[model samples]
Target: MRRLFPVTDQTAAAETTEGAPGGGDREWSLAELAAAYAYPEPEPEPEPEPDHGPGGGGPGVWLRANMVSTLDGAAQHDGRSQPISSAADMRIFGTLRALADVVVVGAETVRQEGYRPARARAEFAAARQAAGQGPVPAIAVVSAGLGLDFSLPLFTSPLVPTLVLTGAAAPADRVAAAERAGARVVVAGDGPGVDPARAVAALATLGHRRLLTEGGPRLLGQFVAAGVLDELCLTVSPLLTAGDAQRIAGGPSVAVPRRFELASLLEEEGFLFSRYRRV
Candidate 1:
C-alpha cells in the first residue's frame, strides 16, 4: 500500500508537495482539514467517564462514510471507482483511514476492489500510538453470506484480524470457513443481511467508536436508511461519465433526506474534497 501525507491548503496553493504520490502532486491541501477536524487535546488528568458508546459522550454512533463521485454523479465507470479517482483523492482516503479505528466496507467492494489488510504506516504511527490506537485501524467487512475468499490476505494476514459482520441466518459452513481462515466472525444482524444499527452496536461493544465506512452503495444505503450515518466525506472528481454508473448513495431510495453541513472543502488537481457533518 502507498503512503500519503497531508499538506496545508496554503502550501498546496503555493507549491506542490515533494515526495507526493501523484494525484495533484501536492496541490491538494489538508491543513485546514487538520484544523477543522482537530484531534482531541490532551487533558492533564483525564477522567474515566461512563461508556457513552458511539460518540463516547454524545448520541448513538459516530458513523462517517467516505465516497467519491464524478461530475455527472457517477461513482463508477466500469464497476470501479479508480477510473474516476485521482492521487489527491487517495491522500484524503489514506488520511481518513489513519484517523479512524475501523473501516467498514461491503463484500462486493471487497471482491471487486481486491481488498487487502490495512498495514501500519510509519507516518501515522506516532499519532496513532499517542491516541491509544493500534498500529493500523481494523477492517470490518459487512456481508450476508460471508462470500469473501478465506485465503485472501485481507482475511488471513491483517495487522488487526479482519472482522466479518454477518447476519444470524448466514450459512453455517461459510461462517465456520471464515473462522477457520483466521477471521473474526461477528453475527450482528438477526435476518439474512447484517443490520446496520446492530453492526454499529457490536463494534461499539468492542470499543471501536471512531467509525468510518467506505461504502459500495448498497451498504451505504443501509446505513443511511438506518439513520445512523453521522458524517460524509465526499470527493468530487473532475471528469464526467454519462454512463449508468451508480450514484454516491446507491441503494434503495431514502424517503427522508438527511442533510449534512459542509465542514470543509479542499481542492487539488481539479478534484474537490469536501467534508460534511450530519445536521
Candidate 2:
C-alpha cells in the first residue's frame, strides 16, 4: 500500500518495499496502519472536573463512518459490500475496528452482513490495555423495531457486551427480549427511531468516545443529516457496478451538502482508501 495524500517523510518512506522485484508493492504493518489512522488527541478540559452533559464543555466525541463504494457510486453490489471489496480494504476495515471504542451499525446491515461479536485481536491487545480500553470494541446495533435474532453470537458472546440502541417507545417485549439475551439496551430517542446525536452522546456517556460506524447507508445518512458525523473513511473500489445501487450515504438530500476535507489517502492495488474530516 502507498500513502497518496498529505504525504510526509515517514509515510513517503512507507511507499517502497526494499528487495522486492518492482519495489513499490508491500503490505503495511499493523503499527503503521494504526499510526496512520490514529484518532486525534483529546483536547484539554477547561474545568478541573469537566462536565460532559449537554451544554457542558467536555472532552468531545469523534464519530467517524467507514464505507466503501464502486467507481459508479454503488455502495454495495447485490445487497452486500463484499463483492466490491479487496484484501487491503479488509485490512483497513479491521484496523478501524481495532482502533474504535465501539462500533455503531444499523440493524439491517447487521442482519444482512451476518454480524458477529468483535473479537480481541492479539496485535492490538497491549495497546488497548495501555489506553484503558476493553480487549475488543463493543458492537452497538441501532434498531427502531428491535427485530433481531437474539441468539446470534453478537449479542450472547461478545468479548465486550453488545449494546442495542433504540427509543423509549420501542416495544417493551422486544426490549426485554434483548436484555434477556444479555445485550445492554440503550434508549437514544423519545420516539421509536433513534436520534443520531443522542446515540453518539449516549455511547460517549458510556466511555466510548472513539466511535466508528460501519453504516449500511441509511443509518449513515441519518448521522450525516444530523450533523453528528465528524469524519469519513471511504474506500473507492476500481470496478464499476452500473445497476441501481445505493450511494455511500442514502436518505433525503440535505438542503445543502455538507463539506469534508481530505485528511489522508492510501492506495492498494487499484482501491483508494480516503479519509475526510468535516470542514
Candidate 3:
C-alpha cells in the first residue's frame, strides 16, 4: 500500500501541466483571464455616531448590553466567555465598543477574560481624534466589594480612563489600591453594596450617554430586573452545547414576562444577531 501511494517522478510534470490546455507546454496567463473575472471593492463602513462626552448627558442616555450565546443559550464555555465567538463576531464586538462612550463590565469578567479596556480599532481612534477627544473609550467596572486585581489592564492602562463604581462603604484599602492603580473611583450606592441602577444614573451624570455593557449572566439579569437597560444586542452562535452553562441572565426568577420590541435581525456566518428595544 505504501509503494502504491508513493510520490512518482512524474508528479512535478503533472502539476505543471494540470492547468494548461491539452497538456501543452504553454500555460494560461492571469492577464488573459482578467477580463472574464471581476472583484468588487468592499463598501466603506459608515462613521460612528458621536457619543455624549463626560457630563454632557442626563437620565435619557441610551444603554445597551451586547452579548453572545450558544444555540442552547449558554453564554460561556466551561464558565468562560472567550470560546463563544468567532472572528466576525469579534469585529462586530469591536464596532459596538467603538460606538459607545463607556464600556461597563463586571469585575469577575475582567479577571476571567484578561480584559484590556481599549478600543481595538484604528478607525475608532481616528474618530475620537477627529472629535478632539482621546484615543479610546472609558472602561467602567462594577465591583460591589472592590475585589479585583489593581494591576489588571482595566485599571493600569493610562490611555483609557478606568472607572470603578462601588458602594460608599466598600473597603477603604481596596478603593485606595484601585485609585493608586489610576482608576477613577465613584461611590454609587448609599448602602453596603453597589446598586447597578444608581451606578447607571451616576454614569449618566458623568456624561456617558451611550453606555455598552458586555456582561456575564448575573450582571445582565440584574440590569434586566432593574429595568435600567434600554437596548439588547444578542448574538446567537451556530453551535449548541446542551449542558448546564451560565445563561445570558441568571438570577432571581422573573415573575411575569417582560416584552422587548424587535428592532433588527442580521445573519452572518450562520449566526443570528438580534437587536431589541425594551418595550
Clashes of each: 2, 0, 2
| Worst 10-residue lDDT window, candidate 2 | 15-24
Off by over 4 Å in 2: 9-24, 48-55
Regions more than 4 Å wrong, model 3 = 1-59, 129-133
lDDT of 1: 0.80
Report the C-alpha lDDT of model 2 over 34-83, residue by residue, as the tens digit.
Answer: 88889998877665444564445577789989999999999999899999
Task: List clashing residue pairs in candidate 1.
Answer: 17-26, 23-87
**What TM-score, to 2 decimals, does candidate 2 have?**
0.93
Instruction: Tell me the lDDT of model 3 at 123.
Output: 53
Instruction: Name the candidate that leads on lDDT.
Output: 2
* Candidate 3, residue 231: lDDT: 84
Question: TM-scores of the models, in the given order?
Answer: 0.83, 0.93, 0.76
Tell me how far the alpha carbon of residue 118 in candidate 1 is from the true structure, in angstroms, after superposition.
Answer: 0.6
lDDT of 3 by residue, 1-279 (tens): 001111345533443655532222333232322211111222444445568434432336677898999988899897777687876566567767766678888888887887886845665566556544456668888888888988977688757679998989989999999999999999988865778788888887887767889986778888888788888888889988888888888789667757898765545567766677788
Measure candidate 2: CA RMSD: 3.0
For each candidate in turn, give its C-alpha RMSD to the true structure in angstroms.
5.7, 3.0, 13.7
lDDT for position 63 in model 1: 80
Residue 267 in candidate 3, Cα distance off native in Å: 0.9
Task: Give the Cα error of residue 39 in candidate 2, in Å.
Answer: 0.6
